[model samples]
Target: MAAKGQEFFEEQRDQSLVKAHIVSKYFDAWSNVMLGVRKQYGRIDKLAYIDLFCGPGRYTDGSKSTPIMVLEHAIKNPELASLLVTMFNDKDEANISSLREAVGALGGVGSLKHAPQIHCSEVDRDAEEMFAKTNLCPTFSFVDPFGYKGLSSRFIHAMVKDWGCDCVFFFNYGRINAGITNSYVERHMDALFGRERAEKMRGFVRTMNPRQREIYILEELAGALKDLGARFVLPFRFKRGDGHRTSHALIFVTKDFRGYAIMKDIMARESSTEDEGVPSFAYSPAEADTPLLFSLSQPLSALKGDLLKSYAGRTLTMLQIYEDHNVDKPYIAKNYKAALNELEEQGQIVANKPAAKRPMKNGQRTFSDATLVKFPALEK
Candidate 1:
């Protein structure tokens, strides 16, 4: 039973490069995290996956949807095949039926080396209620709702309060921006943000330009997630074909720094085109015909100047640098070391170890927690 106006399992929906890129990254991240977690935990008894808005298992073009992707990844890998459980929910019963058919067409989990437990249910209740009833396991939940109505702050707090649970949700920016001005939607917004913060954001959006408004709203969303105990909240934006206004943002929330690092790397790699040096993605169909413009310079090159300026008069260790600036960004210690070397070559810094005769470049040096670095005085 689909909703009155809702159509289930549409045969024809445009799949753009941007959508492909996003989906590809999602699959890659899922597989990588699954393997990494398995390795880190060393043979856990149960691993779970929950998809709140799981559509039909395949697109019209026979491309796999997220649930299908997860199933395929898990079934194909020997280590991930055992004791795996996947729970899929859809508001539309027809969509759930279609997914079942699709999964059956793939020979189902029975064809795999280890059959996984699969559960499909048509959920008429809110997202929070569905999540509350879910059994606690090491879970990766995908909450990609078409709109922003059902996701509340309290729901998010509950989701990430556990140790091994993580979530990737769709933040429909266009929908939010459109409905936010209305008085009726303000209450819903209050559920998303707190009442006081929602009122403040409403007043603030009134004076901002479109770009500023988007940035502010996203920042607020990120802040809300952080307050809810998510250690890392990374957003990947998607835009309409026109290349101006953003359609939605995919927000990944996790409690582990390692998962955060993996997602950042996946996004940076997926978004970028051919050149590893140039990282850029065109979110719009209008720019699909055009080559990917290298809008920003290489991150390492840019970070060198910032590093030199920050450490002009101070001595710091690699751990200190990593802690200070490398937490949220796509950069790691290796990138930081590259930046340090660039500064050292330009006479802006010195890599010093006890009784070392000469300053060493990052490649020639091995940095430990006790390694010391000195930034020379700026030229007068």
Candidate 2:
């Protein structure tokens, strides 16, 4: 199975539009974090990029992999041109050779400003051990495994325990669903969720259908990540081309709200572009075949209602609203502005700020802590 997986990847290196989209989103998120860190810290002494399942440099179609993408971004962006350390690990020596060749073709690390250190190792190292040897510099690690063998809650806990370290990992939902009933896979399940939780989950979802089972497992994984100290966990679902079932989920775990907000924005933008108005966070392949009245405005309207209902007859500053709702599930500060605008249009809320007669959108009006927002009086 492993050999076939590698062969398939090599053969279709340039194929899989789904993978292309996923990788593009990954690159976007990674770039955002790098730039954000630089902007936040002024000048980071060192930044680390680690890819556990680093593939060959280019796909068959000549597209760059994650490592190449990282290097290109660092070279292009002045802020990220500072001291950088990148480690690419893969079990296959051929993949390491290909990645080295690809880096060399791109002019190698010497082409960068700081002469970034690049490490390509063909070893079986897990996240826990890799993180143990890592320096105190801020690190972003990408964990994309073929299955859930080496990934454990304990390892994830250790990775995020350090300040300024975040992770993006691929969770194979299909594989888990398929192997849920197999006794031989029990050990892996135990390692993934911890033995006690795994047994409890197995018993809980034993009678669920495949879809239900997958959802339960995903929820459990997200919960485990939270328990392990990830302040923000966002799961981006990827579906097969047919849009019948999910193939896998890209889970982003971070310790900072800014990182969470950045990823949320990226996922929303990418999914909306691909799904045509349906945000990736709210998309389901099973419902893809059936059409419903879903539009870009629907989310805004819903947000407006939710905010009004939650804070009726109360006043809050724009910052307060964002702080309360930005980190909430299915909604971010980006969604709050539109909802607030819509509420003002309907007289459901009033914005009390200088020259704020009209609803604010984007740069038209800036939200501040002193800006008062009063919801309409609740009926007696």
Candidate 3:
């Protein structure tokens, strides 16, 4: 039995169920590059696409087909087929069945010497073992899932370690808003953050709207992903003027600076289109700009602190920290000093170096992140 027409359209409209963006412009930006890799390689066999939470192949209306359409378009260019392979997985057995049927329908084409190898599965119970079995070095993967539970940081770690591919994941801010703040999520906080971090103790996820809660939770999530080894991540919001909206992110995790540059281009184009009703972004800001009374409610500076914390354990020049972590030299100095001063008062992060003055090119000056030692708290 299939879903009714209206039922299908409703699901297609909201990405919380079926991926709406994939049938939209993000689909174009992602697939064009993927297919181009195949064409450029000329049957060289160096690329693959893994849709981690692929839904059933087509909506009832037939307008919102994704992975199948992507494959159809790529196969048109015979050169691409020789080099590309696609894999799709879903926890739902029905969707997995639909995907295989869809792939089978798109059989041989003229001069399309190679057919894509698509493995449709009901959720990956053990992704690491599957990674080892496939032995495919991927060029790209589409990891758009409905919520946090669909994918795990553990599976993500394996992909980074074993496959070494560029990954695009759906952040689903809605889930973070509705689910993360709930105590139910707290029980599994170790999966979200890590063990050492979880050991630090707290009732962290207080209920909040997506925007309100993200102030702390998302910053930590970014830190966790970094701890899992990811870079060149840009958080993107696709604003559909309909007032009904969804929040998601596209990330590329790779060690090479080249991959970082390509991801920048992809995010810039994806985020900056007229269709999404937003301007394209061209950068990861090097400074958290806080204008007092300007953004009084949700200041970017609040996030600025976590940005600083993420940079801990690394020696950075003022310029380097600004460039790498997105905070101005003045704010870093003031806040860094304020944090240590407060900690010294309450005993949290002990400052190894007392307030000291150093000579600068302009004049005598003070520095905050001058590599201070930790002071252990003494019992009275």
Q: What TM-score would every model get versus the actual structure?
A: 0.79, 0.81, 0.57
lDDT of 3 by residue, 304-332 (tens): 34544565444444334434443211122
Clashes of each: 0, 2, 2
lDDT of 1 by residue, 129-240 (tens): 7566665667777776678666776676566666677777778888888766778788778877778778888888999999999889988888878887787888777655
Report the Cα lDDT for residue 331, model 1. Answer: 67
lDDT of each: 0.66, 0.67, 0.50
Question: 86-130, model 2: which lDDT tens digit per residue?
Answer: 777887778878888888877545646554344554323354776
Worst 10 residues of 2 by lDDT: 271-280
- Model 1 clash pairs are none
Sort by lDDT, top down from the best: 2, 1, 3
Model 1: what TM-score?
0.79
Highest lDDT scorer: 2
Give the residue spans of candidate 2 off by over 4 A.
Answer: 1-43, 113-127, 130-135, 272-278, 282-299, 354-356, 359-371, 377-380
Q: Is candidate 1 or candidate 2 better by TM-score?
A: 2
Candidate 3 lDDT score at position 37: 60
